[model samples]
Target: MLEIKAVTKKFGNDIAVDHLNMVLEPGRVMGLIGQNGAGKTTTFRMILDFIQPTSGSILWNNQPIDLKAKQRIGFLPEERGLYQKITVEEQILYFAELHGMRRSDARQALMEWMKRLDVVGKVTDKVQKLSKGNAQKVQLIASVIFQPEFVILDEPFSGLDPVNMSIMMSEIQRLRDQGAMIIFSSHDMNNVSHISDDLTMLKKGKTVLQGGLKEIRERYGRTKLYIESPLTMSQLRSIPGVTQVTAQENGLLVELADENVGKVIFEKATANGYIPAFSQQPPTLDDIFRMEVAADV
Candidate 1:
């Protein structure tokens, strides 16, 4: 339960976040997306009170976020900060204690996280000695081991391979199921789409789009479909109402100006005796994001 109302941040002459408003409900994940230097990190800092906003306000559970609020918030910054020489268990325990967890409880949490991440043997190893993926896993554990009520993860999937990414995603989903308010920021649109119930797209320090994922995609209009059939891309492109057709490994991707146009093409294909294997959908979050970002430029 986090709310930001008309929040703006200024760095001298530049406005990093301009009247940005967002809401993250309990038990839901919000994906905050933008290009590099699009004010994503600055917005996170303002929310965390690491940097005060120039205008407007940020509230956690309807109250202003103060030091007490900070205690209930967990942050994993884009630039991972951990002592290179510190052992994995030591670093996690230190952070857990910072959040007021008892040493014994912290130790137990550390072991549980290590096993979940499949790095139990690395508990005594120095962070610098761990591989990049392993170090990233350690950073993630440090942020959430204390079980804060609110979690802000910026690029949490940055360096991990697919398997490790799945592990981290499962953990984040578990936290959300337990009713933690989670806000995630990343360049990986697919992962964001998978985990987030809602999404906000930022460009030039302002929100360009914000809504539930499916609603946003439908709002953008259905412009493309993937169809597997006996027809070639050339034949599909020749059909009325079909603007473009490109071949894929298994089928053809057809782009139309409207949903009705796609329906017309399907009807035509049926009449031509071309029964399709399947039809692909249109306008994913990644598609909506690309369209919005490109329009801003």
Candidate 2:
């Protein structure tokens, strides 16, 4: 649904996105992640045509992104855009109209979104009167009220409590199920891992890692293993294949030399009368990001 080919963008002498290439498939969520000032937002701007790239091209379904393509795109920028004094219903309807929806359709979409987000009781209330979480929900609804085919969400979970985060995640998943190609950008690795089918990790405007979550995790080798059993840390370390063992809040995080070693350690744990609660630890996106980016640095 989205393709970026060797796209490069510059601000005078400094490069923002350096020969970055990525693709997003339909009915999938791709998490675009990086450290601060890593060119994630700039890449989004280039894709939306808010800023032209210094070189390279961004394509949506084979053609360059243009006004017609923008109509099918919904963007919720890092800086949330909403009229503080406007009622939730009014603001959403206004955005819907901007997206070419008729007044009646806009109103209907606003009401349905309000109900879905559990903010129907505050539909008539001004955005400023709502809690931060509720206000964020309104901002999200505004972005997708037109049901755009592609949605770009930057830091959508910022400032949201766990409950609200969970609600927004469900809504995003629903959109994906409906075949909306979704690209989410966030620093939160846990959130990215939970929702993303594929992930791209950027560092200083460069692509450090990008692939299906499970595939990337496996590629990084066996970094840690979760173990819940009667075995002591000392006993685990004495095992031949075990390289490092650290206790987690719930269980042990055992590191191995390789996948083969991880298997050997697991067998040793079982042989030692240690009944594991769960015994697999694939490298997380955060783990891979740190390893790859730091190594490159």
Candidate 3:
């Protein structure tokens, strides 16, 4: 288990990370999310010992985190850097060796991970030779070549097309299934919702929300209704208890002040024409993020 208790980081007089606490267990993925300058990266640096926390403690399995702990952790930072001149195969081996894996073992793992991640280029291809998305894939391969017990990925889905994003998501899920405690930060709410077992949302260095996805959704209440109809936004907003209406690809997304208002919308929508689909669900992760974080601004 990985535990961070009341951890705080200060740079000069500025507190970059306020008192923050988190626990990550094996086979679980914790999604860290925040706007720019919210201190998500600072928290990851503290966990990796790249920087020291001014207060509180970080422990792995009841011991203070140190070099031994570092060996078991793999990190993919937001600013990706790879040796442009070296072959993808060589770069991965170098990192795996730095983590204490033998050359032969590292090479074997590299081959397997490369195949699993669906990296298209030959292993001999230099980093600069790959496309932007493929290069990102190679960077991801290097981080987990040895299959560390714990991995931290920052913005893993930053610049990928839908197909590439799907590939990366599958690989991350596979690692989690293999009992690697994973903590990752991403701006993409859809990816986070699909992959994370739990979530922590920070704003101005403080945690505003943290919990399992289902628990968080319950706390927000089910106030969103998806209606499949050709109704105009103005028409939808005319209904009683409808707080907001937005255009959607299929139809309209209606937000209600109370979930009980859903029945009223349904009656009106049906009255206009055939209702192909109607779903009353909790606010999406994106909705919750915008609502909570925007309030702080």
Give Cα distance to truth, residue 65, candidate 3, Å.
Answer: 1.5
Question: How much lDDT does each candidate structure score?
Answer: 0.85, 0.85, 0.89
Which structure is stronger by TM-score: 2 or 3?
Answer: 2
Candidate 1's residue-wise lDDT over 172-271, tens digit each? 9999999898998989999999999989888889889888988888786777788776667778777777778877778788877777777766766677
> Which residue pairs show backbone clashes in model 1?
none
| C-alpha RMSD for every candidate | 1.6, 2.0, 2.3
lDDT of 1: 0.85
* Poorest 10 consecutive residues by lDDT, candidate 2: 272-281
Candidate 3 wrong stretches, greater than 4 Å = 228-239, 266-275
Worst 10 residues of 1 by lDDT: 272-281
Say what the RMSD of model 3 is: 2.3
Colliding pairs, model 2: none
Compared with the true structure, what per-residue lDDT tens digits does model 2 show for residues 1-297?
A: 789999999999998889999999889999999998889999999999999999998999999988888988989999887898888888788888777778898888888888878873478898889887788888888899999999999888888899889997998899999999999899888999999999888888888888999898888776678888777899889887787889998778888777677666666667866484756666777777777767864
Residues 197-282 of candidate 3: C-alpha lDDT, one tens digit per residue? 99999998898989998899888777998889666789888887889988777778889898888887777778867879899999
TM-score of every model versus the real structure: 0.95, 0.92, 0.91
Candidates 1 and 2: which is better by TM-score? 1
